[model samples]
Target: MSELIPAQQLRYSAQLLLPEMDERQQQRLFASKVLIIGLGGLGSVVASYLAGAGVGQLLLADDDRVSLSNLPRQLLYSSAEVGLHKVDCAKARLTAQNPEIAISTLPKRLTLAELQVLLPEVDLVLDCTDNASSRLAINQACYTQQVPLISGAATGWQGQLLALKPWLGQGCYQCLYPDWQDSPSCLQSGILGPLVGMVACQQALLALQYLLNIGVIPFGHLRYFDGLQGTSGQLQLQQDPDCPVCALNE
Candidate 1:
């Protein structure tokens, strides 16, 4: 792994010395590639941490642009970045934060076909998109590709995270939400500015842990958090024996 990444001095030194995560874990993160959808609130934070930790490649995808309203929470963008493509803005900020990171910008919407083209090359998929339709598409793609998916949502101080390791014994995202109903986007409901960053950064932490092969998986369970109350917790993970995807595979 050290041979894979020679830029030791550029980044990853502090991570190697961290108590639970050793040099091996740091090297693992350095060698991994991750794809993040929607370079907005969640995606911005996710990109920051992964690049900061020195993920070898980042497939940054988003078709939106920074707007005046986005400046409150989308730290990757500034007043100057408004009207610029989200992926370009994100790439500029993330690359400047760590020049060693290999970041690619795809400023386009993710159709099922487009997702299939991208997901296979990525070691892991992080869904930072705002809508449930996009989330389910990402989930199904990962399930088919045998890739792990890290998903998080935040709106108005409430947020949750769920991990779908399809290749593992755990169930995929659709298995957990089999009904497949569409949910309200943050724009519709009006999200709290800072909470988006919190949830996104948390998702990034879990992503890094998974890539580094360190923390325990939150399979079949959801971790919920409320920033207004300063509270957080996890709920039980129930496997559906009749889940269309997981059951058939099992």
Candidate 2:
């Protein structure tokens, strides 16, 4: 950990002013590494905030290309980038946002084995994928590596968030959705832009808190946000006795 340069101090002065944040915490954020899967609506917001906040290293993975339909919420891409790979576009945008941090791009979906290999190097992970298969795979890998995970989803007028600390043995994502079934994606169900951003911001906020050791983040709890009503609620999660993914950990 090196001292914060004058430029960095000025750039992050707002954060340093917080009682929970100081030069040491700011340096921790600068040295931390985060892996984010999916570059959709949620991924877009999470990646942008983490980058802007000065996360030292970011691993971005998404195989999809930017599409015109994505503009509504995937703010990382533009009309000119509609056919470009999302990871590439995201890398460019995030790098341009903060040239100090390092960014790595994986332009394809990762298999469980791939995630297992990658998770060990990451300090934390953000599961921003929209499907059950991707989310389950990420959860399994994070649990195996004993890394913290922040998972989020949004579709139609609803959004969900979870911060899972696997080593705590509280509960894993599989425990919440034992069947590993996912609802229709935003593509089919239609999503409001702000609805997804709300969840993404929560996901990013939890990540920052976890990394900086600040505030009481609700790990192992499911947070639900109703876009239409503009209200949110939370439910504590419990590990299932029969949850194959996390049962062996107990």
Displacement of the residue 218 alpha carbon in candidate 1, Å? 1.3
Candidate 2 to truth, TM: 0.97
TM-score of every model?
Answer: 0.89, 0.97
Task: Count clashes in each candidate, considering only residues at least 3 apart in sequence or on different chains.
Answer: 1, 0
User: Which runs in model 1 stand beyond 4 Å of their true positions?
Assistant: 1-7, 21-24, 167-169
lDDT (Cα, tens digit) per residue for candidate 1, span 71-112: 877878899888999999899999899888798988887987
Q: Score each candidate by Cα lDDT.
A: 0.81, 0.92
- Best TM-score goes to which candidate? 2
lDDT of 2 at 146: 91
Q: What range of 10 consecutive residues in model 1 has the weakest lDDT sum?
A: 1-10
Number of clashes in model 1?
1
